[model samples]
Target: MANGGILFLWCSSRLVRTPSFLLIMSLALADLLMMLKLPIFLIGIWCQGPCLGLFGCEMYGVVSVISGMAAIWSLTAIVVERAWVISFSKLGVISKLKWYTAIEVVLLIWISAIVVSVLPLAGWNRYVYEGYLVSCSIDMYSNNFIDKSYVWLLVFVGWVGPNILIFYCSYAIVRANRRNNTLMMELMAVGGDTAQNFQKQRILEERRLWRVSSMMLTVWMGSWTPYTVVVLFNATGYIHLINPHIGMLPAVFCKTSAAVNPFIYGFCLPKIKGEALKLLKRYRSTRPSPENSSRFPNSSPARTPRPSIIHMISINNRHASTSC
Candidate 1:
C-alpha cells in the first residue's frame, strides 16, 4: 500500500504531466485498498474467528470484490486510452483530449465496479467465511442456484469481459504498429519527410504502450486466474481437486499485484523516469540534511554570507574617508 501510495504521489507531482498518469493513480488506489484487506483478515485470525462478525465479513467481501473490479477495469481503461490515442493521433480532434477526460473515464470505471460489488447486497448473491476462516468472500461452495448463477455472472462480467477487451485492444495496437511500420518503410524508401518523422515518433510511443499493456495483462491474469479457477471448482462441488490450505494461495497472489504496480508503472517509461529523477534531486536539495545543519548551526547560508565585525568597521571607515 505504501509503495502504491508513493508511486501515485510521484506520478501526481507536476513532474509527470501525462494524462495516463491518472489511470496509473487509479490503479494504485485500488491496489492500496486491496492490500488493507490483509490486516482485516489478520484481525479475524487473531480473534480466533471472524473478528468483525457477520456484518463485518459481508463488508469485507464487498470491499475485496470492489477493489479487484476497480483495478482490472482501470487497467483495461488504460489500455483502451493508449490504443485509441495512438491509433487516431492523425485526427486533430482526437489528439486534443485533456487530462480531465481521463479522470472522467476513471470515475466511470469506479462506478461500474461499485455496481457489480453491491449486487450481492441486493440479494443476487451472498458472502460468507471461507474454509480458512481468516477471510470472507463470496461463498463459492454454496449449492444454491442463485449462488451458482451469481458466480458465473461474476466470472463473465467481472473477469472475462475486461480480459476480452484487453486482448482486443492489444490486437488493435499490434495491427496499428504493423501498419505504421510498413508506412514508415515505404516513406523512407521515397525519402522521409517531417510527417514521416512525426509518424515514427508516434509509432514509438504506441510500441511502448503495447509492451506495457501486454505486460500488465499478463501479470493480472497470472495473479488472479488461479483464484478464479479455484473458486469455479469449489462452486462445482469439486473442492477435492485443490488442497484446502492451498485455496488461500490465489488471494495472496492477488495482493502481490499491488506490490508490482509501482515498479512497472513508475520505472518503465522514459519520460516519467526522467521526471522522477528530477523530482528526486529536487527533494534531496530541499530537504534539510542533518550533516549540513550540524556543521553550520548559527551562520547564514554561504549563498549570502554575513559581514564580520571587522568588515563592518572597515566599511564604516571607508565611508567616513569618502565623506571627508
Candidate 2:
C-alpha cells in the first residue's frame, strides 16, 4: 500500500513540471522497485530460510541484487541532482539536454544492476542456500575470487559510494542555503529593491529543497547503515556471528524506509496535499445530504450525506483559495 500510494503521488506530481517533482518521481520509482522485490525475500523467509536452495536461488539472487543496486543508484542520482541544482542554481547540464535524462538514468541504473547481479549465472560468482533461512545473499567468504570481487563491487557501488555522494550533496545543499539566506538578509537590511525580493524567494526555494533532501538523506542513512556496517564486519571476519534472524532486521528496516518515502515526498509538500484535499472535498460535496436522500426513498448508497467533514473541508478550501 505504501508503494502504491507513493507511485500514485509521484505520477500525479510529475504533471507539475518542476525539478523537485521530477526528483520525487525518481525516488518514488526506486521505492516502488524495493517494495516489489520485498515479497520475494519475505517468501523466502516464510519458507524457513533463504528459499533459493529449494527453487533455484540463483535467479532470486540475481533479481534481488539488481533491484537493490537500482535502488541505491537512484538515491545517488537524487543526491547528484540536488548538488547540481544547489551549486549551479539551475537544473544542470543533464536537465538542459531536453532528453528526459532522469528517466534514462533510472533505466541505466536498472540495466547495470541486472548485469552486475547476473554475473553469477555466467560463473563469475555463485549463489548458495547459506544454511536454510529463506534469504539469499552473496557468499562473500567463499573461496571464489569472482564471488569476493562481486561482493566488493556491490559494497563500493551500492553502499559506500552512494553514502559518500549523498552525504557530500546534503552538506553542500545545507551550506549553500545558509549562504543564500545570509546574503538575502544582508541585502534586505541594506534597503534592497524589488529584485532582492525575487532573490529572497529563490533562496527560500533553495531552503525548501535542502529540507527535503536532508529528510531523504536522514532516512537512507538511518535505514541502511546498520546493515552495511554489519556486512562489513562479517566480511572482515571480525564478527563471525552470522544469523539469518539478524538479517531480517535490516531488511525490515530498509523496507520500512520505502513505506515512509511517499509521505515524505507527497504529504510533506504543502501544495500537493492542499490540491489533493481540494479534489477530495469536491468529489464528496457532489453527494446528497442524508435527509434529502432519505426523503427520496429510492436513493442509492452513493447519494448519502457527504458528511460534516465535507462542509469543513469546503470552508478550508475557500479560505485557502482566498488566501492564495
Give the lowest summed-lDDT range of ten residues in model 2: 90-99
Against the true structure, candidate 2 has what lDDT? 0.68
Q: Highest lDDT: which candidate?
A: 1
lDDT of 1 at 46: 85
Which residue pairs collide, candidate 2?
A: 49-133, 49-134, 50-133, 50-134, 50-135, 52-57
In order, the Cα lDDT scores of the candidates are 0.77, 0.68
What tens-digit string does per-residue lDDT give for candidate 1 at 174-277?
78777777766766665548767766776787778677767877887887787679767876678787764777777777788877876676556677667667
Candidate 2: residue 47 Cα off by (Å): 4.3
TM-score of each: 0.76, 0.72
List, residue by residue over 81-171, the lDDT tens digit for candidate 2. Answer: 7677766673233434233776677668778887888787777767655434555556654646667777677778878889889888888
In model 1, where do residues sit more than 4 Å from their true spots?
A: 1-12, 15-19, 44-49, 90-101, 189-214, 235-237, 290-324
Q: Where does model 2 exceed 4 Å of error?
A: 9-14, 17-23, 40-56, 90-97, 129-132, 141-143, 190-214, 270-275, 282-297, 300-324
